[model samples]
Structures are given as C-alpha cells and as structure tokens.
Target: MTSVQQRTLYQWFEESALRQPDHPALEVGDEVLSFAGLRALAMTLAERIVHKHGRAPRRVALVASRTVAAYAGYLAAQRLGAGIVPLNPDHPDQRNLDIAQRAGVEVALVGGRSAGLFARLPERHRPTVLELDEDERADGPVPEGTPPAAYDLDGEAYLLFTSGSTGQPKGVPILHRHISPYLAHNITRYGITPGTRLSQVFGLTFDAHVFDLFATWGGGGTLVVPSATDLYSPVDFIVERRLTHWFSVPSVVREAQRLGNLPLGRAVTLRHSLFGAEPVTAQHVALWREVAPASQIHNVYGPTELAICCTNHRLTGPSARWPQYPGGTVPIGVMFPHMEGVLLGGDGLPADEGELCVRGPQRFDGYLDPRENAGRFLSYEDGGRAVAYDGSAPLTDRHWYRTGDRVRRVDGVMVHCGRLDQQVKVRGHRVEIGEVEAVLRRHPYVVDVAVAALPTDDGETELVAAYAGRAVDPAVFEAWLGDQVPLHMVPARIRRLDGLPLNDNGKTDRNALARILATREGS
Candidate 1:
C-alpha cells in the first residue's frame, strides 16, 4: 500500500493505468488515447527530457495549447518530479519569456501551433525546445537509472503566474501535498468513475484546469477537450461528446443564452454542471437548467492561493427552493469539511460579513516571491482580533490566508459580495460595483453588464457601464435604474456592445472595459 507521504500527482494517473490500461483516458477531437497509450507517450517524453539534460529538470515549460503535447507534457513533467510551468501562446512573447526566466525552466515542450511562439524566445532565457509533432512519435527509451525519485509529497508540483497589482506577474507554486486533498475530495464528491466523461474547458494557464486534469485521471475517467468553437456552443459539445460532467466559467452560460444556442433539455447525457472563477447569477442557473434538466448544478468558489476551490454550493430541488442572496447571485455555500474559515469585519474583529480568511491543508505555503506575502495573511489573537501578518516571524499553518473577496453569511451559508477593491468611492459615497451590476442585470433588455469606475478630468471617479444585450435608450435605462437604486449608482455614460470582452479565463475583463471607457471618454 502506498503511504500518504509517498503519494505524487503522477501516481494518480499511474494507478489508473494499472487498473484500467485499456480504458479511454483522453479524448482530443477524434483521437482517443487509452490509459496505457497515454502512459507510454508520457514515458517517452520523460525519457526525452532526461536524455537532453542528462537528468530530469527542476522545472519545465509547456508552450502548447489543447494539443496532445500539452497533456502528455504535463504528465511527463510529473513523472520526472519537475515543476510544470504552463505558458500561454496567445500572450506577448516578452511576457512568456519573463515567466520562463522567473521560473528557471530548463526545457520547453512545444506543440505544432506554438512552435513559432517558442522560437520567439531569446536564446539567453529560452529553454531547450522539444518540438512535438502532431503524430507524437518517440525517439527511444530512457536509459536505466535516469529517472528521479517518483514520489515526494512535499515537492513542488507546478508553478503558475497571475497578474499582480504592481503591473507584473506574481508566481504561485503549489506543492503536491497542498493539492492532494483537493483531488481526493473532488473525485469522490463528483462520483467520478471509469465510465464518467469530464469536460476540459479551462486553459492551462488557469488554476481550474488542475481539477479538469487530475480529478478525471485519478478516477480513471476520460477528459474530453473542446475546440474554440465548442466553447461558444457548449450544449452541442456536451451532447456530441457524451460528457457526464461539465465545468467552466459562468460567462459561457451567459454567452450561450445570448446566442440562443441552448436548446431545451438537449444536454441529457450530462450528470453534473459546475461554474466558477466568477460570480454566478440565478438567471445563469435557470437558463442552464433548462438545457441540462437532469444535471446537478453547482457554483464553486476559491482563489489560486487556496488550491482550485475551497467552497461549493449545489442547487437542489426546484428553482424556487434554491437559496437566493443579495446581488442576485447563488450562494457560495460552506467551506470544505477539511478547512476552517472566518469572516473579519473592517475593525479586524469577527463578523458575519467582511473579508473571508481561511486556513487548512489546501492553503498554499506562500507566494514564490517572499515580498509578495506582505499583508496577505492574518494571525488571530486570543481576543479574536485579526492581526495582519507583517512577516516578522516564520510563516506557519496557524496563519490564515486573506482572500480579498468580501462575503456575508446568510442562513449559515456564505454569499459572495464584490471584492474589497471593487468597492469604490463615488462623490464620497462608497458603492459596490457588484451591487450596481446586479441591478443592471434585472433589466429585461440587458444580458450581461460590467460597471467600472473611471477617473475624470476633474480628478474624481465616476461610474460608467458597458452592457451586452438589446440596445436601449440610455436616458430611459438610466431613469429606470435611478428608481431602483440611489442616484450615485447610476452610470454617467452607458455604452452598448455586442458582447462584453472576456479574459483568457472566460471572466468579464473589467480592466479592458475600463480602458474602453477611458478611450471613449477621451474621444
């Protein structure tokens, strides 16, 4: 029997392969790779890495998208006990190079489409490139005694880069122990089995992809990859792929509703549907239920610092029975059984509504840059006052990670409010942007909306809104909005767009909307 300390992320897939060698493990378009087949490919790639570097690298970069190289390369890195660093081909070359340099990536695995992108890397910071063709051919077997120790629970599994407030990317490294419990809990919670088929909608750059990969592989299930078009029409993909499980950002549901692509009760094969990385509205759930009538709907919430997700809410019974909260969004439910959470008020005291702080097995140790850890954690005193961690002492599990998002407890369930930073002052009145957006979404003509506070020439901030749906007269909409909320919440300028811009993670890009509003204000 494998001890808990001897478990690695790669061991999950290896176990599935031994149990069900012929089971279909991955489905990329028409190509389906069985568990045994994928294991062989990963072994071949791992051998290539060892042969090129004379040993397994400490970190490897994956510059591929939804290609076979991406999936196989991920497993290959795990097999060699190397930390995986996934790069986006769509990002600027300098940005990707900066990530590679920061992570100290020794080798890069490139797919056919990303070959040009990898070539753009300067030799000074560029890793040794292994161009994987579409055929996925292997050169030779790995020499004996080349592979490193396969199991190390404390070893770093992967390193991810997220946008920082300082105009740079912050590195977050997740260890195998930190993520093992997450995978174990979800695989059983979702009823994953060899017959289950899961959807892979998130890109490698997003942390949500961690669930799409390990959870499915660990349970001996199939991971079905979708194409670019499939994302816009997910209902069609769900029916065609015969997927039993589906997960993506809530924006996909809104886009499908806007495009009229969700047919009534068409996704009969799906058993579970999950939405996260953004707040989910009741309307999104209602529309999705119309299509996947028999599927269990869930809204999961978490930050990258807390693994994939720390809390989840399942919508059971009818729509009327579902818990409705302020901001017209679904409840975030409770924290996982293995974790503990507390809400801190503005005065650093315990409260029913405030910043959510958590501490548990799933919480990461700290950011890659020690400087980024300042003020990101909290230590509770005997009197229950939360003190901000100033890095005066060694960081320990006793400290709780401060998730910047605000939430309130309703009927013992946590409901997400807007982020603390999203609370902006307009004419000396603090207004929550999510509250404004929630009100705007009530209008029959509005499908999706994003409200931003932009700077004015007079050095004051004002509200501006960009909405996607039917074009309505701005004056009429503003008057209707003013009647519902205070006058300050109303936007000074309203713009109608065919659709709101989405970031790589499929969430509404508020920064891009702010830029657009600023540019239009100048124009």
Candidate 2:
C-alpha cells in the first residue's frame, strides 16, 4: 500500500536516489540537487571521512543550519553509521560546545558559515573539524575498501538538545527506529509523490526539520527551502516556488495575515498544508484557507520528546467548519495508529480532562540523562493501567511517558489545554497563559500575541502581554480584554510591536519577551 519500505533514514534517501536519480531532491534559490546528485555527494564525503579517520567516527557533530553542507554532512554521518549531534550555530557558542562535549563528539563537520566560529574554539575543547564545500564534487572512483553503509535502525541516529527550565539544555536522542515508522506513516498519509514539492521552513535544531527533510525525500518528493528574505514574505515565496506542500508554525500564518499578504485565490499550488509547534487559532486558519483554498489544512501536535507530530486534525473545509477546542485553538485530534495515549487527571486516574500519557511503537525510550526521568513517566504492569502516576513506582519499558501536556476529549477529538506547567497562580487563582493568549489572538486587530508571567526582582509576578499589530492604544485593548475575561486574567502590561520575535524553531520567543519586559522594569 506504500512505496517507503526503508529500514533506516539514509536507506530511504538511497532508495529515492535509486528510483528517481534525476528527480529534484533539494532546492534553495537557484541551487538544486537531484536525488542521485545528493546521494553521490554524501557518499563521497563519507568515503573521505573514512580515509581521514581510518573508519567512521563514533559520533559526529555539525553546525546544523539549513544549507547544502549541513544536509550533506548529515547524510555522510548517517552513511558512516555514526550517531549525529547537530550543533545550532545560532545558539550561544558555550551552549553548543557544552552539548558537543556532553554528547562525546569525536568529529565536527564544519559548514562554511560556521567555520570561523568553530575555528576560534579553544584547542582542547575543539574536535576534529572537517570543512564541507557546497560546490565540491566526487573527484574519482570510490577509495579502495571504502567502508560500507553501517546504519542500523535500532541504533542512535541523532541527538537534539531542547532548552531546559533549569538553565541547562536537555538532550533527547531520537533513534532510527523511532523515526522510520514516523516517516513512512506521514509519506503515505500526506500523499507525497515524486513531483510533490514541500517547504523546509524549520531549522536543523528543531525536530520539525526532521519531518521536512525526510517526509519529502522518503516519498521521492522535492524539498523547497526558502531564504531568510523569503520567510518574511511567505506568500510570495510560495507562489514563486509553486510549493505543493506547505508546513510551518502557526505564527507564520499570523504574520502573513498581519501583513495583508494572504488574499483569496492565491497559493493555489499547495495540496497539503501542515502547521504545528504552537496553537492554531480559528482566525489564523480562516486567513490560511483564503490564501490556500485548494490545500487541505491540518493542525498537528507533539512535543520535541516525541518524534515529529503524534496527532493531527485535518480541516474538512473552510475555517468556519474547523472545530475549535476549549483553549481557543483547533483540536489536535486522535493519536496516530502506531501510538497509544491515555489521559490521567490530577488524582492520577483516567479522566475526561488530564495530562496525556503516551507509549507505543514510535515512543522514545528515554532522555540522555537518566536522572531527568524522575517523575516524568508512569509505570503499570500486566495490562492494568493505573489511574494516576506514582513517583515512587518502579520504571520499565511498559511505562508511558508523561507528556506534561493537559488535554481533554471533545467530541472524541483531543483538545490541548496548554502545558500543565504553563498554569500560573495569579493572586491565588490558577490562570493558563495559553488561555489569555488565545483570547488576545481573537481580537480584531491583534495578529500575534505572547503572554509571560514575569517575576520581578521584588518577588512579584506580573502578567505581561507582548503583541504585534496595528492596535496602537494598549490601554483600550487591555480595557476591552478586561471586559471580555476576568480581571485577574487581563495582562498588567501590554507591549505592542510591528512583529513578535521568533526563536530559531519559529515559535514565539517568550524568553525574549520576558527579557524585554524585565529591562523596562529596571530589573
């Protein structure tokens, strides 16, 4: 029923290369790499790596920006069966270096953009750096005794670090086994074909990038990457490239709508549109429908801990027909057939509203640090699932991962209620920041909004709202919002900007907003 039968990620690409060697695999601006071309380049780099190191290094780290070198380096490392640790060039140098050291990196594949940065690292801290050239070609025949492709589906594939609340980055190891089925399911579900053109909007650091890269390649489709300029004007980029599949964070939709760029009867080439990483509001979905009338829109949901997205709700028709969840966003829908999910209330028993617990074929085993597993999982035995998670209980593979996300089933569809930790005690009342943000986004002029419960130096927490749009009078907006919601729910401070700052993953930068608010308070 499906064309994708590869055991590993590299194998998927290799099969695509074999099936349609001349088919366009990657495109950025005028540059294009056919399946055969990309495979040849990656293999050539892998062969060179074997020659230099006598064998494949155990772990390879590379600056994971969206570039030809980054893509090639990833394939080369996979071809060598070496686990990859992608270093975010945009992240702080110390953080990247810390992750590199922590992951026990043996080699570094330096991209042209990050060569200088890697070059300046202290000698003791630096690994063996192999510079990758975008224009380099395979010079001669394969070197004698060139090592064979060694990737195993069960082995570690890549290491991704997510920002931790404790000021340290948490490392999550996504294995080939975890993602192989994920890629296959999406390729078939999304109806990807050789001629299908998908957008690559997420950076290498984010897990969504995994979907952008493999979903297209796995199904023998073309991957269209937009330049930084193109991202600011997504409608123009979508039209110019004639992208058939569009995927991005919901914020991009809001941004496009704010600029008045999403007019009706445009973006006709899009066949499947997917958005995740943040809540999708009704207004945003309506705007997207007008722009991409022919596309089937879906609001997918998952955490970085899970591979790509675990669940999605497809819009059957226009935005007005889209189901709205209690949190004021679209429903996230049911779990994929390959996974199982259970909701446990505060009492740790199955409830209509509770934290989501997931475990199945695609579920990740654990985090890099065993200690981080504390209280993050639920264990049960012999098919008897527990109603509540007991922190003192013993752990095993049978345990379900505590997603930390609260949700409820509305009309048999899962509706996200925001993160369990996102709930803040405001004046002894529990307030979900997501709830405030959702309501603010519904305002006529508010295109994008971010809410933060910033703590002042005096041990007081202030609810601050940062938004981007044409609503000039913050006082009027706040007063109107107060009339709509409870008094405590209204943001104490409103800061309006031309646009909300986005992090590398394209999510609204809450930390950046908190810092801006703190600075104004002279903290």
**Clashes per prediction?**
0, 3
> Could you tell me the TM-score of candidate 1?
0.81
lDDT of 2 by residue, 210-252 (tens): 8898888989999999987787788888999989999988766
If candidate 2 were superposed on the true structure by all CA atoms, what would the RMSD be?
A: 10.6
What is the C-alpha lDDT profile of model 1 across 1-523, one tens digit per residue? Answer: 1222235789988899889999999999989988988887888888888888778888989988887767988999999999899987765566687788889899988877677665676767667888877778444443454475478888888899865555356788999998888888889889999999999998897888989999999989999999999988999999999999999987676667668777778998988999887677787888788889889999999888898899999986567777668988899999988888999999999889999999888899999888889899999855778899998787899999998889999998999986787666564334667777877888999999998988676435689999999998989998888766556668899889888889999999988989888786421
Q: Each model's TM-score?
A: 0.81, 0.79
Q: lDDT per model, in order?
A: 0.83, 0.77
